[model samples]
Target: MIRFGPAGNGNSFYEAGHKSSLEIPEYLADVGLNAYEYQCGRGVNVKGEFCRQLAAKAREYKIFLSLHAPYFINLGTSDPKVMESSLRHIAKSLAAAKDMEATRIVVHPGSVGKNSRSEALARAERLLAQTAAELMPSFPGISLCLETMGKINQLGTLDEVIGLCKLDKCFMPTIDFGHLHARDLGAIKGRDEFEEVLDRIASSLGAEVVQNLHVHFSAIEFARGGEIRHRTFAEREYGPDFEPLAAIIARDRLTPVIISESAGAQTEDALAMKELVQRYQTGEGGRDV
Candidate 1:
C-alpha cells in the first residue's frame, strides 16, 4: 500500500495530548495515516523487547514501520578507526530494525569532509559492501536505504546513491524530494520535473522500485549550501509542493511509502498529502493546486 506518516512526533502530537511513542500507531490509524519512521537519528537506544512491542502494535494497526539510522555514521572517513565505528553503528541500526521488524533503515551516504567526493564515495562503497556481506544473510527482511544528499558537499548525489545501491541487491534509495529540490534550488515544481526523477529512478533501478519506492517529502528552506532546514507546509515560499508529486504517483499507480519530515506538524502535513493523493486517485478534484 502507499503509506504516509511522520519522521517523529511533532509539537501538535504533544499538543493533542499524546504522551508516548507506543501510542503513535493507534493515533496514526485514527488519523488515516499508515506509515511511521522511528527516529533513531541520535541512536538506536531502545531496548529489544520495547522494539518488539512497538512492532506488534504497528502490525496491529497496519502501520508500516521504518527506522532512521544514527546521524553519526560516516563510512566515508579515511581514518580506519572512524570507518570501523561507522560500520558498527550501521550493524547496530540493522539489528535494531530486525528487532522491530522494520523493513528499512534510512542512512545518510556519509559526507565529503576533507576528502574529494569521489574518494569519500569510493571508501563508503567499500565499507557498505562489507556491511551488507556481514549483515544481510542474518537479517534478510531488513534493507539499508541510501538517502539522496541535499548539501553540495555531501556524499549523496542521486547518481552516487544509485551507484551505492549497486553494491548490494538489498540496497534501496531513500529519495527525499525536499532535499532534491533544495539542492537544485527548488527545481521540482510540476509533473514533468517530478516525472523526470521517476523516469531516472525506474531506468536505473527497475519498474518495481519505481512502483514501490520509499520516499521522504517536505517543504524546505535552503541557501547556497543547500537544505538549510525543513519547513512546515504552511510556509508559502519554501517548497517542492506535494501536489505535482501526488498527481504523478496517482497517475502511475505506485505504492510508495512517503514519510513527512516537516520542521513541525509532520503528522498534519503527512495527512494532508495522503488526503490529496487519495482524492487524486479517486478522480475527485479541486483540492490540489
Candidate 2:
C-alpha cells in the first residue's frame, strides 16, 4: 500500500493535546495516516530507550517510520574536520534509526560551495561511498536515502541523487518534488512534468526503485536561488499541485511513502493527498477530488 503522512508532528497534533513525540504514532493512526518521518535535522540526540518506546508504539499502530538526518551534514566538504563530523552524524543517525526500527534515513548531499557542480558531486560521491563502506554492514536493515535538494547550488538534483543511489544497493533516492519544482523555478506545472520525473527514475534505476519510491511532497514558494519556504495546501497560489502525481501513482499502482512537509499544516495536507490518491485508485481521476 502507498503510505501518506507528515514529515513531523503538525500544529493540529499539539492542538489535539498531545505533548510528547511518543504519542505521535497513536495520534497519526487516529488521524488516518500510516507513515511518519521523524525529524533529526538539527542533531541526533534521541535516547535508545526513547527510540525503543517509539518503535514499539509505531509497530503497534502499524505506522512505517523513517528518519531525516542532520541538515548540516556536508559530504562534499574539503575540510577533514567537516568531513569527519559528517561521517559521525551519519553514524549517529543510522544508530538512532536502527533503534527506532526505521526502514530508511534521509540525508542531504550538501551544497556545491565554491567548487563547480561536477567537482562537488564527485567529492560527495566518493565520501558517500566511503561512508557506506564503514556504516552499511552495521545497519543492514536501514536504507540511506539521499534527498533531491531545493537549491540550485546544492549537490542533490534528481540526477545527482540517482547517481548516489547507484553507489549502493542499500541507498535510495528521496525525491522531493517540491524541491525540484522550486529549484527549477516552478517548472513542474502538472502531470506531464511529473511523469517525466518518474520516467527518468524508472529508466535509470529500474522498476523496483521507482515503484517503491521514497518521496517528499509539498507546496512551496521560491525565489531565484530556489525554495523560499514550504507553504500549506490552502495557499492556493503555490505551484505544482499534488493531484497530478496522485493520479500517476494510482495509475501505476506504485507504493511509495509520500510525506508532506507543508509548513505547519502537513498532517491535513497529507490527508488531502491520501484522499486524492484514493480517488484516483477508485478510477475517479479528474481535476476535482
Candidate 3:
C-alpha cells in the first residue's frame, strides 16, 4: 500500500535534534506515520543488537523501514582505491539494512569531479555493476535505490539512474520530486508533465516498480544548472504542484512511500500532503494548476 510519512523522526517531531536515529520509529508510530528512513548521512549510527531491536519494533508497529547511506561515497571515482572504498561503504550500509529488515537503501550517484559526465557515468556503472554482482547473492532481499540527484554535476538523472537499473533487478530508482523540480528549474508545471514522468518510469522499469515507489518531496531552489538548496514547501513560489501530483497518485492507485524533505517542517508538510492526497482520492477537491 501507499505509505506517506516524513523523512526523519516523527516522534522527536522537530527538524534539527540530537536524538538517536533508532528512536525515530517509535516516534513515527505515535504520530500515525507508517514509515521511517534511517539517515546515515554521516555514517551508520545503528548497529549490532540495537539494529535488530529497531527492526523488531518497526515490524511490531507495521512501520516500513528504509536507509540513506553516507553522503561521502563516490561510486564514480577515477582512482581504484577510492572506488573500492565507496563500494565498502555501500556494503556496510547494506549489511545494516539487512539486519534492520529495511526494504531499500537510497544511494547518491557519484559526482563527475574532474571527468566529463559521460566518463563519470561510465565509471559509476562499472563500479555499481561490480558491487551488485558481488552482493546480490547474499543481500537478495534488499533493494538498492539510486536517487535522482538535484545537482547538475551529480551522476544521477532520470535517464541515467533508470539506465543503471537496467543492469540488475535488485536496483531501482528513487524518484525525488523535489530533485526533479530542481533539476528542471521548476519545469514540472502541470498534471500532464507529472503524469509523463510517471509514465516514463513505468515504460523504463515496468509498472510493478511503481507499486513500491520510494519518493522524496519538498520545495527546492535552483540556479543556472540545477538545485541551489532545499526550502520549506511554503517558501517555494515558482512551482512543483503537489495538487496535480496528488491527483496522479490517486488516479493510478500507486503504492508509493512519499517522504517529505521540507527543511525542518517535514512532519507538518507530510501531514498536509497526506491530507491533500486523501481529498483528491475521495473526489473532495478540485484540481488546481
Candidate 4:
C-alpha cells in the first residue's frame, strides 16, 4: 500500500489534546494514515519500555513505523572524533529502531563543508560501509535509509544518495522530493519532472526499489543556497505541488511510504496527499500535469 504519514507529531496532534507519542498510531489510523516516522533529530534517548509500548500500539493500528536518526550525524566528516561520534549516533538509532520494531531509519548524509563534493561523498561512503559491516548484522531487519538533502552544499544529491545505497543491500534511498526541488532551485515543475526522477531511480536501483521507495514530500521555500523551510499544501505559492506526484504514484501503482515534513501541518498535509492518491485511483483526480 502507499502509506502516508507525518515525519513527527505535528502541532495538530498536540492541539487535539493528545500528548504522548504512544497515541500516535491510533491518531493516524483515525485520520486514514498508515505510517509514522518518529523523530530522533536531537538524539536517540527513548526508553526501552516506551519503544516497546509504541511498537505495540503501532502494531495494533497497523502503522508502518520508521525513525529519523539524529541530525548531528555527519558521515562525511574527515575528523576521527566526529566520525566516531556519528557512528555512535547511528548505532544508537539502529538500537532504538530494533527496540521499536521499526523497519527503517532515515539519515542525512551530511554536508560538504570545506572539502569538495566528491571528497565528502567518498568519506561518507567509507563511513557507511564501516557502519554496514559493524552495526547492520545486529539489526538484520532494519534498513538504513539515506535521505536526499535540501542545501546545495549537502552530500545528499539524488546521484549521491543512489551511489551510497549501491554500497549495501540494506541501504535504501529516502527520496525527499521537496529537497530535490529546493536543491535544484524549484526545478520540479510538473509530472514530467517527477517522472524523470522516478525513472532515474528505477533505472539505477531497479524497479523493485523505486516501486517501494521511502518518500518525504512537502512544498518548500527556497533560495540560491536551497531549502529555507517546508510549507503546507495551502501555501499555493510553493512550486512542488503534491497532486502531480500523487497522480504519478496512482498511475504507476507505486507503493511508497510518503511522509510529510510540513512545518506545522504535517499530519494534515499527509492526509491531503493520501486523499489525492485515492481520488487519482478512482479517476476523480485533476488532470495529470
Q: Per-candidate TM vs. native?
A: 0.97, 0.98, 0.94, 0.99
Off by over 4 Å in 2: 287-289
Inter-residue clash pairs, candidate 2 = none
Candidate 1 or 4, higher lDDT? 4
Model 2, position 155: C-alpha lDDT score: 84
Q: Which is superior by lDDT, 2 or 3?
A: 2
> Per-residue alpha-carbon lDDT of model 1 for 115-210, expressed as tens digits?
987899899999988988887778897889999878878888788888898778889999999999888877887877888888888998888987
lDDT digits (tens) for residues 3-79 of candidate 2: 99999899999999989999999999998999999999999989999999999999999999999999989987787
lDDT of 4 by residue, 65-117 (tens): 99999999998988899899999999999999998999999999998989988
Output candidate 1 Cα RMSD. Answer: 1.5
Q: Lowest-scoring 10 consecutive residues by lDDT in candidate 2? A: 280-289
- Candidate 3 ranges beyond 4 A from true positions: 10-18, 236-238
> Which residue pairs does candidate 4 place in steric collision?
none
Please give the range of 10 consecutive residues that has the lowest summed lDDT in model 3. Answer: 9-18
Question: Deviation in angstroms for 248 in model 4?
Answer: 1.1
Q: State the lDDT at 129 in candidate 2.
A: 89
Candidate 4 residue 40 C-alpha distance from true site, Å: 0.1
